[model samples]
Target: MATRNIYYKSKTGILHWLGLAIAIVLLDQISKIWISHILHYGQAIRITSFFNLILVYNEGAAFSFLASQSGWQRYFFTAISILAVVVIVYLLKKHAHQRLFCLSLALILGGAIGNLIDRSLYGHVIDFLDVHAMGWHWPTFNIADCGITIGAVLFIIDELKRVRKS
Candidate 1:
């Protein structure tokens, strides 16, 4: 079964994880604010051969999905983010004792709140930290994206390990 009951063995505190989430949110917001102040839109400052500190605004989901929509995507995505945050919080409380699972959920919760704050305040998410190479460019992203991505990966890896043991 793919249930979450497998992680009732270990006991990890929830407050620390929540604190980490809050710290992530603060860092993400501060970085976005600093970059927004330093660079205008469409400004790219090359930091390396394949990396840049660019300022870009995302009005859509990951990789600019649904970006060209007729202004409705903003509310849609905001609602989705809010819903995800709520669900993630519930999971965190229920599985707070599961260290890896809680860690992943906390990171995800932080990332969601970070992006959600942007979506509420700016009507879009401000993204910097551009990476490109070999004449190819990946989508510009920010700290929140990094947290969400790493958290998701860790979640998958933990689930895999649990499944293997069972």
Candidate 2:
């Protein structure tokens, strides 16, 4: 008689994805809280000539691109985030067997949830990391944005690799 391998088949992997997503959200939220309480808005704690820790509020999308749209951006961005979260969850459930794809979805889920918390609670997103050059400044961002960007890049890379493999 052959012994069947039951360990891998018995495992339910939802927790793995959920755990990673929650961890990312927690870290992002905690950092934002620390920045909000310890750093004044528009004030920078200079860590280096190129980088600074500055507390800024963003009501729009990446880099504060639409942050000055007469205050309607808050709701727009919030709606966009909610829709994104829903879509990501569906994709994750559908492709849970794909490790890289599922991980990317998890990262995006955490990031979207992190920013959504801010939009729902404070009506704006708290941004703290600042980069500067030539006496000019780039828009500040937080961990959630970094996670989302990284996840996006990874997703693209995964797709490219899949194509090459086939």
Residue 108 lDDT (model 2): 83
Q: In candidate 2, what residue range of length 10 has the lowest lDDT sum?
A: 6-15
**What are the models' TM-scores?**
0.91, 0.88
Candidate 1 deviant stretches above 4 angstroms: 1-11
Q: Which predicted model would earn the best lDDT?
A: 1
In the range 1-166, model 2's lDDT, one tens digit per residue, is 9887654431436567768888889999999999889988898899998999999999888978788898788888899999998898788766666788878878888998999999899989999999998989877889899889888988998899899999
Model 2 clash count equals: 0
Error of 1 at 36 (Å): 0.7
For model 1, what is the alpha-carbon lDDT of residue 28?
Answer: 100
Q: What is the lDDT of residue 131 in candidate 1?
A: 92
